[model samples]
Target: MKINEYNVVAIEYSLKDANTNEQLDTNVGGKPLEFITGMGQIIKGLEAEILKMTVGDKADVMVAPADGYGEYNDQAVQVLPKEQFAGIDLVQGMTLYGTSEEGDTVQVTVTNFDDNEVTIDYNHPMAGKTLMFTVSILDAREATDQEMATGVVGGVASGGCCGGGSCGSSGGHSHGHSHGEGECCGGENHKHGGQGHGGCGCH
Candidate 1:
């Protein structure tokens, strides 16, 4: 059946920067990325197009910045006192995690720094970039009430690649689904389908 709201969907996908054709992330030969449909578990653009596909289908989907991580905001860039980042060796372009004002985990990149001040970009690393997703649908089915309620596939927790808060990374890159800010899907402690927040860079 075509994917619909709360349907558990699994797919193997490879993401690339549309402009530069730089491969960002992929799960082609690994665990399939699974998420609930119409629940904001994944990027808006990707979900919209995935709705048009069915199991066993493959296609390329392009997502604009607005539908992906959102446009890069100048206001998201801030210069804070270097003292705030004490105890860590700061490197340019390195991503750092911190709690936001709302107590959510926020990922920021070290853009520049000096002895007194540090410049960080709160915008997601993929912000303002169009993404290309080569996707192959592996499975799609209606979610049970429990699964829908918990946003967990099969309504049971397991330690899959990107499951249960472990973002299964390669070279420090995560290929899990991304939503609000840096929220990641399939986190066991937090409800999935946009209810919880975690760390993952793939969008």
Candidate 2:
């Protein structure tokens, strides 16, 4: 059937950085990436293209940074004095959680460091980079009543593709109770996933 909202579609895709050709994510030899269409379960740019594809279709799609993750925010980067970091051992490429201005937890990545200061960036890891994907739809079908009701894509019975319960993974958002097969936060509002990669299990 043609892909549509509330439909489940499985795709075998390899995601890469458009500039550096770095593989960012993939689900080909493993559980094929699946989501419910019409739902914002993935990047907006990719979702728009998936809407027009049919099963067995193949395409190499590119998404701008704004449409994929987003542009890096300079304001999000803060170089704090060495004194700001205490107790924790600092590393060059480690991710650490910090409380935001509003008391929300934000993940910060250690980007650079000096003797008296450390630079951490709170931007989404993929921010500022274009994404490219080689995709082939493996399967597509209408979602089940329960699946649609729950807004979940690959559940236990579907041999869950994204093993992580949190789709937010390394993104700026949190999965709540979701793994990589992200659902709406708390699975309450599956309509919008979040900032960049949003949605429930709607492929």
Candidate 3:
């Protein structure tokens, strides 16, 4: 089936930083990632790639910073008073969540610390890096009524991917779940199965 709006698709992917050629994410030994298309569930570049695919098709895609996470912004870094982290053990190289000006939840990394200053970087880890994606379309089909209602494709009837008696991974890991019979996160479909390279890091 051709991947289109509301169609379910399943794909295996390997993601890397184009410039550094560093592996960023992959589907090896992991569940296939699912989502709804044209619904803003996946990254724009990936969505665009899916639109050009057919069932059983495979392609290697290179996404620029603009199409991926955009260039890093130095202004995103903020230095806060160390006292703000009082009561929590502070450590370097730790990741923390913070609110952006637009009130969106953002991930920040602790870069440095002094007697009173805590330096945090708000840029996304992938920001400024070009992305390389190798993807194979495994399955693509129409969404079932149940799947559409629940807004997901692969799990129990509760419509949630995790957080219930539904199928879940060990160690708090989870793949996308379906709410309806044919409903998936996007118009893709498939389960992940393969060997882990280093460890199951979900990437």
Clash count list over all predictions = 0, 16, 26
Task: Report the lDDT tens digits of candidate 3 across residue range 73-116.
Answer: 77766677777766545567565543333433334556788989
lDDT of candidate model 3 versus the reference? 0.55
lDDT tens digits by residue: candidate 1, 19-121: 9998877777877877778666677788888899888899999989777777777766777777766666777777665444444555566789899987877
> Worst ten-residue run, lDDT, model 1?
186-195
Error of 2 at 203 (Å): 32
lDDT of 2 by residue, 14-110 (tens): 8788899987777677867667776666767877787888888999999896676567777666677776665557667665554444434444567
RMSD of each: 6.7, 7.3, 10.3
What TM-score does each of the candidates earn?
0.76, 0.68, 0.69
Deviating ranges (above 4 Å) for candidate 1: 154-203
Positional deviation of 39 in candidate 2, in angstroms?
2.5
How does residue 96 of candidate 3 score in lDDT? 54
Name the runs in model 3 displaced over 4 angstroms. Answer: 100-103, 143-203
| lDDT against true structure, model 2 | 0.60
